[model samples]
Target: MTSIAAVTLEVADVAAAERFYSAAFGLGSQVRLRASEAATTGFRGFSLSLTVANPATVDSFAASALAAGATSLKPVTKSFWGYGGTVQAPDGTIWKLATSEKKDTGAATREIGEIVLLLGVDDVKASKKFYVEQGLTVGKSFGGKYVEFATAGPSPVKLALYKRPALAKDVGVPVDGSGSHRLVLTGTDAPFTDPDGFTWESASSLTPAP
Candidate 1:
């Protein structure tokens, strides 16, 4: 089955982007997969991997992004809610940093909450059919325009189908092109919405499986 893989970006310098992210978020290091000799590395985390460009052996376009504006938004620091960092890339894109550790709730069971993913679609029925055939079971159907899907059993992943215009109205954003959004959920692939049409997915709050 086809799944969303990586969200790529273009950057100017690998080292500069690395330092920019590390200094801003206090992240660790990573080496390139194919280009061991080339100047490339990525960050960790499901949301990590700030790709930098190679001057001599440039591979992807992300290397070009470092030249945009890449500025520091929030310096590396910890907070009551969680550890945090923030940066604005050269392209004027904002990136936030938070503690990767799962918080302890001081209870016998794990807690559960909602984590939503927004996906772009040209036809809701077509997309829904595709996902259903892939073993993603439908939980609730919101008329012909919207459908909710769950993994299986007491699944952690929840999929919501939303029309592009409806979603834009809900968020109070003008129905323009889709910008960028992050859906932080465990045991699921990252879902990205298209420029205008989008998909909405959610995750149940973590809870004890019993």
Candidate 2:
């Protein structure tokens, strides 16, 4: 089965991006940085989701990200889904810190539970089918609206799909965007680009699995 080994982010400055990631979220090796001059604008068609234990942890991560030079897209707010917020990193990547739990289980900590790479696509069904063809197992599905893929990669980053417009709204961004996605997925499968133009390459081992 196909599994993502690393999430490589194409940035203008790899060193600066490295610093921001370390200082902001301390994501470890889940994210990789590569220098690129690819032209990109607007939403970039994806977001990195950071799931925490409670509202307090979400707040802490948000505060840390902002302090590390991430631009605030949406401040932390509670919703029916959970408590969360959106922030844009200095490297132009969007991050959503969220938690399904509404209440704080205990004192807030710097621990992060899961990381899901949410790719905004034009068609969920088509994309889902394409991924299945590539050997990714379907972990969850909700018709044409969303799909989550189960993975067995060494570096564990889960994968999920959502409509472009809907995903943009969830991340608090405008739908209009063009040019390079500025993102790449390194996985165990042979190199190929998905229907939405996300490139997946074969890698030995990496973080953020699916």
Query: For each candidate, what TM-score against the reference?
Result: 0.35, 0.94
- lDDT per residue for candidate 1 within 1-210, as digits (tens), equals 232211222344455655554443233322111101222222211122222112111111122223334454454343564433444454223443333333423331111122223343446677787676654677777665777666444432334566656544433334554223322222224343333323222223223311
| lDDT per residue (tens digit) for residues 1-210 in model 2 | 466778889999988888898888887678888889999999899999999898988998898899999999999998999899999999899999999988888877878898999999999999999989888899999999999998774655899999999999998999999999999888754678889999887765443422
Model 1 gets an lDDT of: 0.37
Question: Residue-pair clashes per candidate, as listed?
Answer: 28, 6
Model 2 bad stretches (over 4 Å): 204-210
Off by over 4 Å in 1: 1-112, 153-156, 178-210
Q: What is candidate 2's local distance difference test score?
A: 0.88
